[model samples]
Target: MSDHLTVVDHPLVQHKLTLMRRCETSTSEFRQLLREISLLLAYEVTRDLPLTSRQIETPMCAMDAPVLEGKKLALVSILRAGNGLLDGILELIPSARVGFVGLYRDEETLEPVQYYNKLPSQIGDRACIVVDPMLATGNSSAAAIDLVKQAGGRDIRFLCLLAAPEGVARMREAHPDVPIVTASLDDRLNEKGYIVPGLGDAGDRMFGTK
Candidate 1:
């Protein structure tokens, strides 16, 4: 709901997203397109990264140039499909510190529980971006954000390929300060909690599963 939550509607992003939505898209093509879209989204996500002036000698002459300033960003992948997004973001910002958080849904309780957690040292001082391909129920994503917060990550943002309205509302209610970026917002979750008309299970599609 906040202005910070930007839905990137760039032409390139839209084109790739359309291809990704096709049921016929091969796993290889889907993965490739996700990576490409991630890179394009990264450009928009990092547009506000602080820049500092530095003197550098170019082929022409020494001139003041703008370079990334202060602490490098920490890109955290929320496991599985999140890793796909991480690959492309890393391609854009190769020097960014990387982290991972893995969570699984407890069948009976339907709550997310962490299985793996690894974050950069001194996360409080770094801007953190969490990547997950889909924001469906928002349970896992919210839990991942909680894990990042416990690790001292204060400045955080989330990125996803698709999100359900319920998921976005849940996220906003739970963590209003953390803005989310996604390509599209679907209607709502079905009885099974899958985003209606969603591209299906991102993990399944990305990994070539049922």
Candidate 2:
């Protein structure tokens, strides 16, 4: 509905996200909530996917029904935190191709560096969805999308569990053509780069680490 990022306000998504935000939530519970919320978010993300008419046999007579049109989906998880969202999305779209982009922050430059990359062949022809839990600074996320585009991924979408306004603004400026889907858009980023009123580090929480 809005430009740039689409916030999914579904009651279930909000309810589960609340559990995820609580300080007492266990690692197991947090992981479960991430999967559930990501699945719910996936439904909204794929809402406008193109469809084509297909001939099908009903209980009695033959009928023409609508089926998804175009190439299979290419899911690129911005590794570590992004993997949390990937598992649930795959459950919903089992046949979707998978890709991974490993990036780490350059402490000095505050930039993103690619450490790993593995994507399906002909990424340009497929519809690509990049997943990440939090969009804090937007440097890594933007860099990941840039790599995807360079690999020929023209139709791209970004999915996240939480987003900060600063990060959203950065993404809009960097990649306006790629729409963003997230559960909530938070107030702002703190001095340390953690989102204010944010759900904390997604990778550490999901994996039960510091």
Candidate 3:
């Protein structure tokens, strides 16, 4: 709570989250709203990106203007659901390098196993942002971070649409160096490892699956 977690509580972000939480939100609407909300959350998660000044000539006169410093960020998506957030964030930071960690949770054991892995070269030189919509159990997210670290990602952050208390604790224990940014930190995870009062399976809603 002190150093690791960040909840984007902006008015527009909250309002869009409420619309997304409803049972009746259509797939198209949910996707669109998520895109809109991700734009706002992007502002919060990347708030601390380093900046350096470069001399540039403006319409008025030459000035030392601020610009992003160092290599572009590496935006890593944790498989299918993560792509939802990834799309919108990419819209905002078009030059960011992209990567993916394909993982799915084992239902009975509630553990994450990797199925695919790809990362940008010189990832250690880039700040990494991992995007996944629901931080339910945190197993998959933590495992995804493990892959990122193995691939030489040093500076990393996590972003989600909703997070449960259990999931946050799990992530804190596993990767204290990585910060988490989300739309809402929810009540708890239900018996089946779903976030209580969550917007149901985000993948189902986003892809219109059962």
Candidate 4:
């Protein structure tokens, strides 16, 4: 819950990420690896969820068992690329509430421009996890977080496959309360706002788009 960032360095995650970074990796392979890796990332992100004891009858005798406390989690995807992460996470936490925040960067201004947003009515009551495959400039991610805040989202976390130093710094400065969970924190971003040594455009890679 503290203001910080978590980099998942599990072997499986690292291995899958390496494959994803390869330019020769096919679209289908990339998507498959992303799905597989996301499951591992989801495990780390929800590791600290609050739990409560519930009395349940086992096959033998009745006993108190630990169960997730409070409302179901809210999974918010930050548009296009986020959807790729969303699908995989959903497979792991199928009961979680789903939401979306749509933002696209302006080619000239290089700023986020919001286009669409829809969230659960009780977002504030749940622990929200915002998913995006890549955190580049952090402009779009920061803007998405702002919208979540305005919509009554309180306990929020950001999750991504890859992150750049610039993006991480931006998030730390803009929303220190929200923790970041990513697979890899790569080097600095390039002049064009892309993460160095990143897996190209995440959306394009996943969907075979230009």
Candidate 5:
């Protein structure tokens, strides 16, 4: 894929995303909606995955069938919030390898500090999708990607439910080679570094936390 952003505008994805954005949506419903939407987003992210033909036996005869080429794709969740998206994508790409990069923002500096990281052995040879629900400031996301690269991830794409203009710009500058895919690109980040008009604290909303 080109080095650009892809906003998934499918009707179902938009409708489900709307539900997720509502303040009154319950944790159970919000989680369900995120799962539903992530499936559609996965479809778009993997749209151009390379395919190879293999001989298969049909009921009537043997024929060549298309199958995914190379090693199974890798799914790396960017901790807490990313787990929501990860669960859904796993349902669709069940055979994919899994990894996690945990980061928490330092309140004083508003910068990301890595606390945990575990990646697949063959990450460099496989396509890796890093998932997070919100791309608010992009610091943590970029840091997570850097960790993935350090662990040998080369072909990487970022997936998020919502993104702010500031966050998109940050990603563009820091990692232009990594394509970004999201459901919506909101206006901008607020004073506290949250996405404006965004669903409040995706991790808190999805997990019923304060």
Candidate 6:
């Protein structure tokens, strides 16, 4: 898609996201809402997956049926909070290959620090969708995408629960080829580089960690 950013404004997604934004949402509630919303976002992200027909026979009928054309798409989670989004998307595309890129933002610099990386063997052969719950500074996301490319991943797309305009701009400048999909693009990043009016630190909210 030519659009660099896609905001999944579907009613279901928006409603669930609103629930997630509430400060009092319990850990269980936040997790459940994220799972539900990720499925909807996944549906949008995978909408154009190439299709081909496979022959199938029924008791009284035989015909070609549409099936995904190639290797199942790759779903790469950008660590920690990304796992929250990953779990739900996997429920929707059960056959997808999974990968992970672990990164932590350096508190002082607000830049990404890589801690771990693993990917499917045939990353290049499958469409890749990278998942993260927040796109704040975009440093980590861009760095994660760099690792994906280094591992031979192409046709990559980014999916996030929330994004800031600064983060979107950062991605556009760093990896214009990769399009981003998010539930909402908030106003701007605060001085600390967090998305203003974001649902707080996604990892903390998702896992009930400090």
- Which candidate's lDDT is highest? 3
Candidate 4 lDDT over residue span 51-157, tens digit each: 99999999999999999999999999999999888999999999999999999998677799999999988899999999999999899999999999999999999
Give the Cα error of residue 45 in candidate 4, in Å.
0.7
Q: How accurate is candidate 6 locally (lDDT)?
A: 0.93
Model 6, span 149-199: residue lDDT tens: 999998999999999999999999999999999999899999998888988
Candidate 5, 1-210: lDDT as tens digits = 235799888999999998988888999999999999999999988988899999999999999999999999999999889999999999999999999999988877879988889898889999999999999999999999999898888899999999998898899999999999999989998888988899999999989997
- Writing each residue's lDDT as its tens digit, candidate 1 over 72-130 gives 89999998789999999999999999999998767566678888999999999998999
TM-score of 6: 0.97
Residues 39-143, model 3: lDDT tens digits: 899999999999999999999999999999999999999889999999999999999999999999889988998999999999999999999999999999999
TM-score of each: 0.95, 0.97, 0.98, 0.98, 0.97, 0.97
Candidate number with the higher lDDT (3 or 4): 3
Across 40-141, the per-residue lDDT of candidate 2 in tens digits comes to 999988988899999999999999999888889999999889999999999999999999999987766667899999988888988899999999899999
Q: For candidate 2, give the lDDT.
A: 0.92
RMSD of 3: 0.7
Mark the 10 consecutive residues where model 4 has the least summed lDDT: 1-10
Evaluate model 5: give its TM-score: 0.97
Model 4: residues >4 Å from true position, as ranges?
Answer: 1-3
Our model 5 lands, by Cα RMSD against the true structure, at 1.3
Candidate 1, pairs of clashing residues:
none
Better-scoring candidate (lDDT), 3 or 5: 3
Q: Candidate 5, residue 76: CA error in Å?
A: 0.3
Looking at model 3, report the run of 10 residues with the lowest lDDT sum: 1-10
lDDT of each: 0.90, 0.92, 0.94, 0.93, 0.92, 0.93
